[model samples]
Target: MERLITYKLPKFGFPRLLAIIGCWAYLALPSQADISLTFGTYAADKPTETVRKYRPFLSFLEIELSKALGEAVSIKMVIAKEYEHSIDQLANGEVDFSRFGPASYVLATKKNPDVEIIAMESQKGQKRFKGVIAVHEESEINDLSELAGHSFAFGDELSTIGRYLSQALLLSAGISGADLQTYEFLGRHDRVGTAVGSERFTAGALKESTFKKLVKSGVPIRELTTFDNVTKPWLASSTLAPHVVEAMRHIMLEEANASAVKQIAKHGFLEGDDADYQLVRDAMEDSQSF
Candidate 1:
């Protein structure tokens, strides 16, 4: 038989007892109250520049979240190599939060129904933005109909304004990809604008902001037509804590100010619903036949 074992509590002197009590008290407290989160996105421009532009916004999120949650909050920004990569990260619950274009948000939800929309970006006080199909200033091709025989440049295959909506615009003109002499996905709005401005391609499509920026920089491009696009939607990973989601939603919807977050969504955010992207969904579905 195993020997019976018994132990007696250690007798503590005054100093030792105080130290022992203090150690027990420290161990009994919650280990950590700080909250750490990951924010994911795909770069629409140079990755370095994208990170630079977003760091401040991420810091603002941390500050606001901390204030709302009554804990130290930190958010690490993660920029994926491409759109689909970021979408996968969000849809797979690999990241705590992410911002996505309308088309990407739709694609993510299609991929993982559990993904949730937290808010929609509000630009200039409206939850709407613009995309443009542009051509060289002197190009005689004056309309979407005129793009039939010309080569074209497009932004990322997954970019909302760059690919789907722009392609839908072409389809509405009764033009199809087969009608174009050649077309390629250049993967960035600025690149599409540059390709069109340099006459490398007869035409291209990109966001209105990028088109305006390129034109202002003497890129010599002109918007042939403009199309309305819904603003981007912010998403939360399915596995994120409900309390954290609530905190994030509160900060984004009520506390965001220009001085703090003036990145792509300059005016902050508004409550978003999946139905808000119906137009983009239609465009995405329609463009699939192309």
Candidate 2:
């Protein structure tokens, strides 16, 4: 005959069982806050226009990030009145992530050591992009040397291509700020292009992409010369969760997502690090006036 003895199961108090259930519930809840991506006014367009231009790409990023992270994500267009403000937003945690021109990233790193470069923009399959000095197609000014004594326009003073690289090129040609009859900051690349195209300014400096785009759109301007390449970067606040950052990096590098990236006027994105922007730091240190 089988043994008749049977063991009794342990029982927990009501309070203990409730505690266990509560712990399980906590584990099942979502673990992250919504993400915020901030961008500066890189063009002359109004804030609404800037938002409109970026909406498609931002929407794509939002959807992908949410899907990957299992949490909601959102874009917060900071629309910085000045380029420096964008850097400030990233450094101070006003935004979780941001896209910075090379010089701005360098300056932001200086201001806030917590700034990190995670990815860079690529266009035409090249990770590097150049700055350009532009003038009216019919302008008599034919060379950087001729820019002396002529009124000049610049985009944001903190702009890498629009101001710093442009300043460096001018310095190489012996045209210092004092050499210009006058110089003004128009606050955006498109404004600089429009100002130069209309002959409102003798010359201006802007990103090669912006210059080319303006020309393609029938703006009457020509590139006077090109400057050294600057590595454009997408930066994240160090305070961001590691997983969130990795998710963004992954999305950016995914070849299948190239179409989404193209909405931002880029061929794609590449892994980037702070060291990649050392040249920008060197350029900024060398040209402080801009």
Candidate 3:
């Protein structure tokens, strides 16, 4: 296994380490609860810097959830500047709930085995997603194998289709992450596409819907193509009880409620089981074997 476990460093030292490990073991024993939830996101910008400008869609997320829950929920939205840190926070119970891509969710489950996936997103009601290796229309790269030594941009290391899928494709094509001349994290899909189009990166990964949205908004569709494709979907995290999971799942399937979630991330939550996320688990195992 890749052993993508997340650990917390106690403020004291060795004694606290033993205690924390023991506590984790105890929590892994499993319990149930009905409690107010706090949600976290990997989207918030840095703390000490000016916010990364974006559309006002986030306000709608807060508003819609509040309406659905019929109470003020504590949403501790923060930027996941580092993927490991995001998983660590979730593992330590610093955040009770979160959303993650396929790779991050798998990594998180390793550390917090009790963590439950609560929801998943889809596009046009389709949960299957793919990774795309895109370049400018005038660029020379035409295939995943041709990307060697070329500069690239990844959305985030924890991204399912963003980085992991693209990397898997590259590795399958006999290229390694180290073979890249340079690579950068543009943070989000839009920036990744924009960076590639502006020549900051020779090629990059993009979700299919993001590409379509860009084109629909008047960006040139001829700017990119699929060098490779990998399927991924949205996932939710919860350390709550099964009843809670079942409740949320039921609420998410309500057509009006589902529509609101879909508007937030281009996909709505759907009923899922352990098998629904097996692709991510399998990919993680395969990546670690390398």
Candidate 4:
């Protein structure tokens, strides 16, 4: 008589074998979790212009961040024909992150609550800059109040120093919207400076950096005056993954700490948070009051 043979299959049947194989396959795949970061900057120059042309005055934060992240990063230069269009792109997540002036950041955040404040440029222990209005030496405009009822020029309506800050300053001086007979957005800061210099506008407002550059380029400063100083220059963006954000912070700090980066960025951007932007946001609120 043949002995009854005992045959025991493994506890895991074919289904279990398939499950094990799937798990192993998943583990072997490459992780695409690393963020695909995109960055943009306000183009104070022409859209067609190469960013390399103004490398001296331009911020290289994007390049620095790309190096720090240990991954590929794309930097898109934006020359917004209208401030609204730029803000709309950012709100819809067409752009992952950006470095915006105070006014532009406010407009973007108003549309998308997901944007986050990551960092800002600072000097003398302050993270603020202002809008300065000026014109050619020949122009008679002397003060913010004097701009009323005159042809006013702005760089970009979304510009913190160009439009919002300048407008806020005008309002503070009791200049009402109806007081201005004409307003123009020249699109670029250089154009704003040139227009004011060429007598195209009675006065114009721009970031101090741009103003300084124009002056350096031989635009006479005698033509311009500080019509208003409403907000500071701040950097901001939409929220990113914690690890990604940390990676960014680490890169900035490390780069800044190195003497070489200081040469590239002119100055290192300081660590910043939502609170650092509060003052900027408050100034923006004040701007709306006008």
CA lDDT scores, all candidates in order: 0.88, 0.80, 0.62, 0.64
lDDT tens readout by residue for model 3, 61-174: 445455555654333455566667878777667776666666777777788777776666654565566556778768866677787888988887677766766666667787
| Position 208, candidate 1: lDDT | 91
List the candidates' TM-scores in order: 0.88, 0.82, 0.67, 0.72
Per-residue lDDT value at 50 in model 3 = 15
Cα RMSD of all models vs. native, in order, equals 6.6, 7.7, 15.9, 7.7
What TM-score does model 4 achieve against the real structure? 0.72
lDDT of 1 by residue, 54-122 (tens): 888788888888888889998888999899999999999889999889999999998999888888888
Candidate 3 segments whose C-alpha is farther than 4 A from its true place: 1-35, 44-76, 213-242, 265-267, 285-290
Model 2: weakest 10-residue lDDT segment is 36-45
Q: Residue 124, candidate 4: how far off, in angstroms?
A: 4.2
User: Which rank order by TM-score, best down to worst?
Assistant: 1, 2, 4, 3
| Decoy 2 TM-score against native | 0.82
Clashing pairs in model 4? 115-238, 116-237, 116-238, 129-232, 134-224, 134-225, 135-223, 135-224, 136-223, 137-223
Candidate 4 accuracy as lDDT: 0.64
Best by TM-score: 1
Off by over 4 Å in 4: 1-35, 48-50, 53-82, 221-224, 227-239, 255-257
The residue pairs in collision within model 3 are 122-267
lDDT (tens digit, per residue) of candidate 4 on 1-290 = 88998998678888889999999999999865343554555565665553553343234545555566766544445545566776776777666555566667767777987776656655534565555687786766677778778888877756767766677777878886678878887877878887887877777877776778788888875544564332323333554556566665565567545464454345656766656556556656776765
TM-score of 3: 0.67
Best by lDDT: 1
